[model samples]
Target: MSTDLSSTPPGSPGAPASDKLDRHVLVIAGVVVLGAIMSILDITVVSVALETFQREFDATTAQVAWTMTAYTLALASVIPLTGWASDRFGTKRLYLIAIVLFSAGSALCAAATSLEMLVAFRVVQGLGGGMLVPLGMTILTRAAGPERLGRVMAVMGVPMLLGPIFGPILGGALIDNASWHWIFLINVPIGVATIVYAAIVLPKDDVEPSETFDWLGMVLLSPGLAAFLYGVSTIPETGTILDAEVLVPAIIGLLLIAAFVPWALSRRNAHPLVDLRLFQNFTLTIAVIAMALFAMAFFGASLLFPLYFQQVRGEGALDAGLLLAPQGLGAMLVMPLAGVLTDRIGPGKIVLVGVAVITVGMGMFATLDAETSYYFLTGALFVMGLGMGATMMPIMTAALQTLRGHTVARGSTLLNIVQQVAASIGTAIFSVLLTNGVKNEADPTALALGEIEDESQLRAFLEQTGIPAEQLPTILRDLTDDLAGVFSGTFWIAAAMVAVVLVPAFFLPRKPPAEPVDQTALMGH
Candidate 1:
């Protein structure tokens, strides 16, 4: 009797029994991590460069902001296509293509001469970057197998967690010492190395017959998601969700997204662009909900961390980034242990504890004042990092552990898209709240002074306006304290949202499945 090795799922009775990741899997992980670092890091890296772009291009803040916004919108637009493309072209081939496309886009972005040109180039870069993370997850998950997923996922989570912390430090160093162009130029060499390494070290694709492409669903979802995210991205600038720029596109996007649900569920469309049918898995659904809430609360509030340092504490970009390092350090210390624990016991208990820890950390931030000690703030960040290390990857392991065969690709895609959307919404909501709060707290005269970028600028304004020198200390003290209060209030909301993640986390699987996952049962094949 002959057995089909290719047909066997990892962790199945007939498949390899070892729970540890071997050298081959480790090498594959290296390749995936390299690509993931580039993709995730780009999002935060450009955030610090916005002011530089504004100066270089002589553009308004809103126009310069498009450098980030365009990339985000383009990234969201292309993600739905990844699952189907992965299946059709194979992960290995598609991965290489994504790397090449991203590298080319990066090169073009560095060479851009105008704001318009840069925005167009960012769209190209985003299209390429869009596929990297989901595809990396799919590759690593299949390579490491279900039994070793927690460890491997912990490895993957490093980039996701550290990107925000390190991006500013790196971006600031490069722009301060080198120039803004180096930010994009730096990726060129890394991308080249990643492409070559991936082509050689990555396994060959095992292609299957392709399904018919879902053109109709693509029309409804991609544009819909892009429009919605664009509106949300503008919220910080618009200051309200009710503005025409925010509302018109958001409502239209929602209508289109609403239409997609039924179209995806229709029997006539055998292959939807994004398979909503996957949500039918009870475990998968709950895990995704928990992930969405965690991401919304954590990522949304994280953007404020550096802003608080720069605006209120009078720190430079690099200094703010360095101060935030404790959070990343905390996450690093616990991620590996969290991974192993998830493998031994299911993700439920681990994630519940993680959310609670995060709630505590955020609560600490809610009480922050301009005079709060650095030691106290860093300590709180470290505690939050511990929770994050335990939370994100374990939640992911829970979501993908039960998925078998082809569902792995689609599942990863779904998770990435949900994370992106949730983070965007959270950012917009928190930003609007903080902006409104600041408006209410400051006196009208202080508000009219506009943003004071530095002490020199503030000094110049005070001297020119003939304000009394005696009142300088009072003015600075009140401004900083009020700004700190706005931040503290916003974090209170973040704490509450983090706590809400507990509801879905409670429903996650508590123990590893006794039987190897049944692919047919989950997929209804």
Candidate 2:
């Protein structure tokens, strides 16, 4: 049963002739990429604006933080329903509706007069924003079919990888020159345009209204994810996972997620909101695990980089963001080549090489000091970007290659969920480590300076510490050195974390078949 090479998709063995995506597939991919960029950029852009929001709204740090927290919670809550919604409403229609909702939320956010109102509107935006990426992946998967998934994912990954790199720079520019409201308002036109274009060109897949909605699964999974993420988000602020604020919700969320697995597995005919059975595929399972580890390492290191630039190097937000651009540029340069190579050589070997590169990049970062050259840092970051660009999309493509038909949507959602959780855990763990490292090395007197706002209070604190006013500069210098050392150690931890990916990468299939094998035939379709 030999399959025609021309008919086979790109990832499958035996079909070199069908490697290039059709023009129609390219157009669809372009549209999906547009929405993905808009949504992901929106997430990262708001991060740089948080301080501005706090001051403008006259709110406490915790209160102003809710602007982001609420949005994240909403996103976590809604992601589980995306698979069912896509099936019930059709991918094209649901995608259009999501855009409209996101645009409406953006408009409302721009018009918000109070922090509370802004937080409310952000939740609305999250509802729509959460659906866009998964649905976009689902749509692209079906359109490109299994064979071309690697190339299609590479295209879609452009915004996902670049959004964080450029988001802060854009946000800083907007805040410095214009009002913060523009951050939310900017999404309006993009969303509207995407909606209109998607409505016109997107294929209308048949709606499966008969597909049973797993209400129990939703109740269990959505809140579980939200609570877990919320707890993790609190770690930077609370300083420890043992805090009641972190522990209670995280435990409950874990219990709920654990419960959902068996409940979902026990279901007979109806599909769970996210199918656990997909984990049965060894390749998909390993890919998912690799992705989770990669997310933790990548995101944790990403957080540390900006803070090191800002706090230790004394750079502003925009400068730090620009400095981060080399990594993204590196990723951009390599992604197309990585995609093509993954198709030809299989993902396992590419991933092994990519992870090795990333580990080397992290090792470079781990050796940084306050006086590290800008050129060296830039080159290292670019290498990290190259490694990430080569690694992430291929892992995603590998997972998708193993899925077919209805399973694709659930698989996308599952991957997104794991990524979100992994990033949160990474952020939480690294944040705690950084905080403790700085505290352990910092001078007690210098640390107390942070709390002394008034000149009189500062003098009183200095007198209490029995330090002369003239010696403050020396203490500050020592403090900077300590911070640099702490950040350097943190990068080492990130490197070690990234090294863990090699274990799972080895599990990925080493080579593609020389001849095209019909994916449908292999899957017993």
Candidate 3:
């Protein structure tokens, strides 16, 4: 992996780009898409399967959460370095290797019998998975060039746009009909096929051996990011910020990132892990910030929604996925139009409208209670889907509008790193809030009146509190109805976070694209 890798020539690895590429390009695109599909599915597939995992492993919620956290942390940490890896190793080589690694990790995860081993396997998968998106973008950039970027991105968005939707559905179906292990087993064949195909098709770019890497920058940047992400993921979401589990690591991580900023900025020349100077481009900086906030707010809802549907509202996994499908479908419906809108009207107006719509959708969700009808929830999800579709593509397109071909992949990688980090943090924050909300909403009076102390005792008391022994079940139903108010408060917090995204959105430049910037320049020391 440390070997010096110069890029291949501009043409196909073994033949002319014009003729050799047509068939080969499809193979390359399939491989790239395959890689992305594997990663994307894992992100959401775990949602439905988490219950199965807990039952099989006899785990607690906090322990099980690590399964999700482990993969995301590893993925977020490695995304920053993808540009350098691709530049050094070439896209085809890196893509094939990543796929094989991911497939191997998938098999290991399926076979794991212990919680620790499963989490560790996911980390391996994440490391390989992290490299796929950027390299996939690189493959497209190399094969299609800027003229075809719009069409290429639009087509490529299919898997990314649908990953969240399909993941839950697949997980639900597999877990219900077969076993949780199948969720992972599904990736194996796809990865192997992709590896074989990419080895044959992906174009190799001419590598300039003259480019120097900032080794010091990577050392500082990677750990700082990993620590920050780990800390964010560990926020004992049910506890307060000052809770030892939440505050200690978070403070340490924050300090590290604080240290990273000054360290990177001081490096005056050569490649940096993240080129700090890229922020000098106002739109690019704004775009990056937008992506972070977008991820934080959006992914936050993702955690809450499923839980609300399944645990609170009592829907099954497949039903939850079916319920959530509107969001993905709506995004797919609007993506192409978003591409055209960005090309025509600039990102500002589109983003403003999208943000507004998302706020409205989330706001409606905030109003939900345990009693809120499922029909209303579905409507809100669709609106969220629309708003998400309307602007994110435009923002991503706008972010890279000024970047060069080779640099586009790198810039996108940086954007993805920030977005993933924000997502992990967002999930953590939401978890904390949800836990607090549930605890707070549990009536102190009811708790005091009941003689039970532990959760089991409280559950038993609540089960028969008002009962003439035979009527206990009916009384418990009444208690559940009364608890509706508590869940609504959780919705309020979720809505508030979504609304907060509007703040950063106000400053997005309405201006058109100027000169195209070099994407590689953003990789800083």
Candidate 4:
């Protein structure tokens, strides 16, 4: 039986009452999309501005990086609290509060006088931003009902996917035309409008009877996730997982997380922090497995795209961001159709096709070299985008469709945690691979260029390395070609991971259930 009674039954749990999303649901989706845009865009926009922050604060690379890391750590720590908080306090009230916190944090960030102050403000921003996605999913899922979940999710997916592609372009334009503060300041007005819109438009959700707070699970999971992600985030900079900075926290984090699993599985805690019980749904379990594989392979390889444009082709940050637009365009073109097809046939058939398309696109990237044509590269990206638009949201729909009542919130939260963790691990793994590749191929002169910030340091660094100054031009040219090979090889690895997603995807529900399964009945097993 369905637990959430917010919306009247359409036709059946698995079938839509109507083919189109009604006006009320559309309004709710709009509010969710607005909040999502602010949260998702901030991650990438701030990333593009890291160099600017470094120069402005006169900080070392490691110190400046904390601006990004602190935000991420804060995000990982707070996400576990969202599903519980939404159930304890109503979703609308919590949604508005999150906006206020995010907005206030953004304002404080803009006014910060030092790097430490900026990092502190970012933590506040992260706490608010972390809740937006899962909460948004809960709000939309409850309002749209199961029949239209795919389409509404597709609408939400647009900003989620586009944020990474467009954030750098927006960040670069603002940095060049304005100042670094604009990135943070940009969120203020949007946040204000979202608050007002949500306050007026979103239907009030009743707070469910609160369950006993999972204090032990929170202690185990929050720090475990924060410590784990902090370590993973450092891997790209440290260039190896073996480093003390990476190993110590990562190992400790893993052990703590391992402890959390059994504790959550125990029968004593009726309401666990993350609700691992939802995995009892076979369709949801397979969907998340496929999602993890896809996220690792696709998002991991995506990190290299801008680097390829900027470092190898020598495009400016703005130009590199612009060059990647075709991928976003391709995703936009296909997502709505994919959503429709998922609602009709089931996510299984569509996902298999999506994975195949992504593999083809990735295969094209795997062959890349320094002299590869831009037309061919853009075409490949467009093809991949089409696949991505089809793939990501459908997987989410597959995980969420069967769960009833509060289980919807639990399912969304679990799906998000898996995606975030998988993407982080994948990024770290691929980054280390590429870094090693470049290091192995480059000589002392090539490595020195990365270390030297100014002309004064260049001569001294060359003297220290004992490389002839006369060969600099030739070394730069050769290093560029070497970088291309390293990236190509890494893309091949990413392509293989994408292919692995198919194994789990093969088990996703092949057709929408003629009737919704009783999720309550499955929870006992």
TM-score of 1: 0.95
Off by over 4 Å in 2: 1-17, 450-466, 513-525
Regions more than 4 Å wrong, model 4: 1-14, 449-471
Who wins the lDDT comparison?
1
Better of 2 and 4 by TM-score: 4
lDDT of model number 4 = 0.88
lDDT of 3 by residue, 1-525 (tens): 111112324453322233222554566567677788888888888877776778889999878888988888788778878877777777777787788889999999999999999999999999999888877876775665443343345556667767877789989888888888999998898888877777766665566563467676677677777777766767754366666766676677677667667665675645556656667767778888887888887776677777777655767779878888888887888767764454444567778788888888888887877678878988898898888876565666666665765566667787777777787777777778776765666554443433344777656665665534565455445445544555566667666776666666666655544446654454432
For each candidate, give its TM-score against the true structure.
Answer: 0.95, 0.94, 0.85, 0.95
lDDT of 1 by residue, 1-525 (tens): 223333557657634455567899889999999998988888889988998988899999999999999999999999999999999999999999999989999999999999999999999999989999999999998987766677889999999999989999999999999999999999999999999999999999998999889999999999999999998898899899889999988888888899999998897887788888888888889989998998898998898899899888989999999999999999999999887777767789889999999999999989999999999999999999999999999999998887767788888999999999999999998899889999999765565454666889878888878878687678778888889999999999999999999999999988753343664465454
| lDDT by residue for model 4 (1-525), tens | 222222436665545666688899999999999999999899989878988988899988899989888988888788888888888988899999999999999999999999999999999999999889998998998887766777888998998899999999999999999999999999999999999999999997777678789999999999999999999989999999889999999998998999999998898877889988877778889999999999888888888999999888989899999999999999999999988777767788889999999999999998999889999999999999999998999999888888767788778888888888888898899889989998898765686675566988988878877878887878877888888998898888888899998899899876753455566577663
Candidate 1 stretches greater than 4 Å from native: 1-16, 448-466, 514-525
Better-scoring candidate (lDDT), 2 or 4? 4
- The backbone clash count of each candidate, in order, is 0, 6, 9, 1
Query: What's the lDDT of the predicted structure labeled candidate 1?
Result: 0.88
